[model samples]
Target: MTIAMPVLRPKSPHFSSGPCAKRPGWSPKKLNTSVLGRSHRSKEGKARLKLAIDLTREVLQVPADYLIGIVPASDTGAVEMAMWSMLGERGVDILAWESFGEGWANDALKQLKLDDVRVIDAPYGRLPKLKQVDGVARDVIFTWNGTTSGVRVPNADFIAADRQGVVICDATSAAFAQALDWPKLDVVTYSWQKVLGGEAAHGMLILSPRAVKRLETYKPSWPLPKIFRLTSGGKLIAGIFQGETINTPSMLAVEDYIDALEWAKGIGGLPALMKRADGNLRVLNRWVTATPWVEFLAVDKKTRSNTSVCLTISDQAVVALGAEGQAAFAKAMVARLEKEGVAFDIGHYRDAPPGLRIWCGATVQSRDLKALTPWLDWAFALTRAEFCKVAA
Candidate 1:
């Protein structure tokens, strides 16, 4: 008889959808008191802000011409700020495939109150037609990666070369973990929690020269909240764009982010980070392929995300159990895996179809994900026994 190897959960208990795992040895306690709830207007805050910007550029390889700044309310606030500041004047095209992108699309239509809005959406794990987007000559709001659906836009080359409108990309899950086609992206925003394994509630906003020009030239009709305001009198508040947040930020979180950035730099920077995520996905890829009961949720090979790998069990498997039985079986499978510590938080997002969404972020080691498959099989067998008992 063979004994199964013991599973090792990371020294941390975080595979959270947001507020992802921190770099191996990061600590908030090490931050200087100057970073601890200092007035955003204070000189101390500016220094911390400068470090974040500098290291973000070093690790992420953001262009020198671009501006990186602290923004409130995580990725949501950052995207809304850009939408409120830059949309409306141009005919807007919103592309949504997954839950977060859907949230943004709803905000553009219902909250931003834009009449010229065109929404192009797809079901989970699929891309909205690129032709549909390129066909229209409008400013675009799209998520570079659909975290909830496990789908991603493979390339931005489909965007019209001489398009008149700006391309705004929400790259929260894609940044740091994947290579971005920055030249084609006019405005980009990412939060530290998803890929960098840092604290949440703050977001990074990157603006290309063209996006800065839009901020300086155009103003949306909506009232700007103190948190969302990006410009002063139709001109970019370049200081806020530098590091001065609109309001105070927890220095502890900033320090944690700084540590993540430094760790990223030491690990061969973006290229290495991307390699880690791809490696994890490859582990998942083998599991999805070898397990007959399972398959990838994303149909297109090119669009399958290396970051969030979602999976669905086949209808045959579902039919083997009744509705309640199916729900219980799925729950038991995830619970069993979590209890064993081989995997946690594999359950799909609430709005997503019933399945598993495993975050294959840089912090997740590939071997850990590979080990998860056997646990999944074990749990499924256990659940299958439950269904069979009723039949007996």
Candidate 2:
């Protein structure tokens, strides 16, 4: 049996989960207004930085009282700043369902070495028991979307409205594409390079009023790195939230982000962005429903991620190869697709189950996903045949 290769290909063959595809019609020309070669503290540079902050608040609909700041490093720096400054005041509960979430957990237990910490974790494809989280006494840290496992917390209902502890969220992959419950979270972190398709090395940290209070009242026992310092004396750094970044930022990347924010607004803000990601997922859903060769990695429909849509080979013959062989087969299929110019960077995360992880973020076009599916079928068939011959 043979599957004919599709003559059509994705108009843009980028499906990487990070440093994702730029917005439709994006290019270096769009960044001409960048305040290059100017001090970020200068009036012109500060205005551009302020515009980025203002646009983020407007587009994300962040609560009126919450503060947003541009920080050094990507989302990792943002998350670490929140943890180091705020966690020692209270007992902490860390949750992990995938690599990024797990990374935060390791930071809490190993690096920070908080004594009164409880970790709730689940394997790659499933979420931990949300009901088990101790909202009454312990601050909580978790990822809203697990980029590697293609799973996400369904909603914020599990968070108690009267929770005594702060909730810090690493939403690098979830922010613009998913609706976040601002009141439920005390600290939230994301990077420009994820859903918005902007350049990397800058992180956005959003702080609720409670998070700010924590910063003002409690200082960590550890020495704060210059990059991670969020407070001055006994008060919050008001300037940080008002375009005064802790460190220098790339004016070129700032311009790129401003461009992306404008694109997001032009397309109707967060709802439109979510619709784009959802539409990409629906396209993959239709393909998965009809195709017997693959299935979603996240078994639970409600928890399946609309952004990082992961899939595993389900054909009986492919399943028989076991984990290592199946990983090799998936790599071969990915390479073939890349060679054909249909898709790139579709392979699963290195530590995840062997499968494909396709970025279905707001910047990805549904039509491109449609064009890529048949190519996936063709690649799978070609790779499967190669494996069978070796076995024979």
Candidate 3:
């Protein structure tokens, strides 16, 4: 059962969901190096940071009133800061359908120890019941896109438009690639490394007026770390949102992010980014629709992610091997692709079900995905044959 190897390979196979493929024409030389050695607090340095923020607002089309800030640690830090600063203000509703979402749920139930917390969850490949959320009375926390499970909320229709509480969203994998319902979200967080394919460690935290009001009014019962502090003297730290970061930042990373933002702006802003991502997903969807051996991990098409497109083996022969065997087969297929230099980092998230998670973000060219599918079929055919022989 020797499968013929595909002659064509993807032009770029740097699809590791995080620190994803750099923009189509990214280069180190394109970055502004002037900010590299300057102190982030210096006027020149702060201007670079401010430019990144301004471009983000322009690219994302965030409401003029919403505040955008580059926070410490990345998306995780931004989420934690929001959770610690605001969750205890009212009863909370947390939703989980993937690892990152579950992690946030654990923080509320285990670490934060909030008094009135309700956790609504679903297994991988499916979304939680959005109707179960009580956003009107309780603060809501959820991820707009589940990077691991490859599921995403289709829209924010379930969230009340006139709710009393705030909605905190981890949009790390969705920003730029998807249109976020800004009016429904109070606190949205993302990282430079995910959608735009920028350098890591820096986080973009966008806060609505409601979130800022919570920060200025309610102080958390637990002690706050300096990095997590967002307020002073019973007023919002307006400076943080204005590029005056709480701690010194990586000026190099800031410049790289600014480079990415500028690139995004040059390419027709948010609409173009979403179209590119959607086009990539369409390429995968057409392949999946025609390929019986594979199907999306996200059960529902409506909730399927355009960015982190997760897929699971549908071949009954592979499924009969049980969980460990299926995982091994999937890994072998991934390894074969990697070894052939056809694709890299296409394996499932460690915490997710046994499957393949291909990053189809905006930075990934659709032609690469179309070229990669035949290689996937070639790899799977060869891997299945080897696995069957081992089982026999």
Candidate 4:
């Protein structure tokens, strides 16, 4: 059956995973107030940077003892910094379920070369047995949300409050969209470009007092790059948390982040942001439940991600395409949607199984998602018809 083209369309069809859709009323003029053309070390530049940090803390409701710093590279750099600075002192445990989580595991095994390391990984669609980690004494590193696979840790219940080691989380896709169990996480990293839809390249690193202590005391066996360095001599660098960035920062990006933070505050704060993301998932959930051709990549509904909502094409026709043909079908469907200008960057991550990955972050309006769902159905129907005819 041919599905007719839907005339109603999403007001904004900018759903790329990383550099996601900007806020509802975002404009270039938002950065006009940016303190540009000044040394980041200058008072004004530092003020902007500090404002970004403070606003992040306020919006996220981070613990008073937790420190937030603007790191050089995106979330990766912040995670690596924590791993390098603290892992060798204790045995390590790495948990992975998707591409980014697996990347961190590889870093621990290959790059850092930590000997006392244990890796527990699950297939893309499922989460690892988090219960196995309840009382482990090793430093633990994992992603709060598996952006590529659309799986997320359901909660922080698996982490013991009195554990000896630290928990480092790459929460780039989860920070604003989901609440963090601050008491359970020792180090948390994210980028502005994710949930808040700000610029890329700048990473936010949040550390509990324990993590800061680890940095101030433990020195890595490997050489520390200037950008990764978080401490000076033997003392924690107080300036990094105070907006003295390790290297020059794009003041423009900082300003944009501040604007996004202000927007988050305006619309109620963390709870409202989480509600928006959850509302997006609710919209997609309704579509997916009604659409027999598509299903969530995440096996468990409880662990399914609300932000990076990934879906697999499950129609018998597409499934018969086999892996290679399914990949091609997904690519074609994505291309069709882009050509129609109804969606962009809806393709799955390169490493994940062939499917669609839609960004349902806070910055994305629910009405856009509501409008986009029917288009997805329309595109999938047309693509399936074309592929079936070719096969026949």
Best prediction by lDDT: 3
Stretches > 4 Å off in candidate 3: 390-392
Best by TM-score: 3
Per-residue lDDT of 364 in model 2: 96
The residue-level lDDT of candidate 1 at 281 comes to 88
Give the higher-lDDT candidate: 3 or 4.
Answer: 3
Model 1, span 217-238: residue lDDT tens: 8877778888878888777887
RMSD of 3: 1.3
Q: List the residue pairs that clash in candidate 3.
A: none
> Which sections of candidate 4 miss by over 4 Å?
32-34, 390-392
How close is every model to the real structure, measured as TM-score? 0.92, 0.98, 0.98, 0.98
RMSD of each: 2.7, 1.4, 1.3, 1.4
**TM-score of structure candidate 1:** 0.92
Name the weakest run of 10 consecutive residues (lDDT summed) in model 1. Answer: 1-10
Residues 1-392 of candidate 3 have per-residue lDDT tens digits of: 45678888899988789989999888999888986778899999888888889999999999999999999999999999999888898899999999998999999989999889898999999999999999788899999999999999999998999999999999999999998999999999999999899888988899999999999989889999899999989988888888899899999888888888888899999999999999999999999999999999999999999999999999989999899999999999999999988899999999988989999998999999999999999888888888876432
Candidate 4 residue lDDT tens string, 162-256: 98898998999999999889999999999999999999998989999988888888888899888888888899999999999898889888889
The 10 consecutive residues of candidate 4 with the worst lDDT sum are: 383-392
What are the Cα lDDT values of the candidates?
0.80, 0.91, 0.92, 0.90
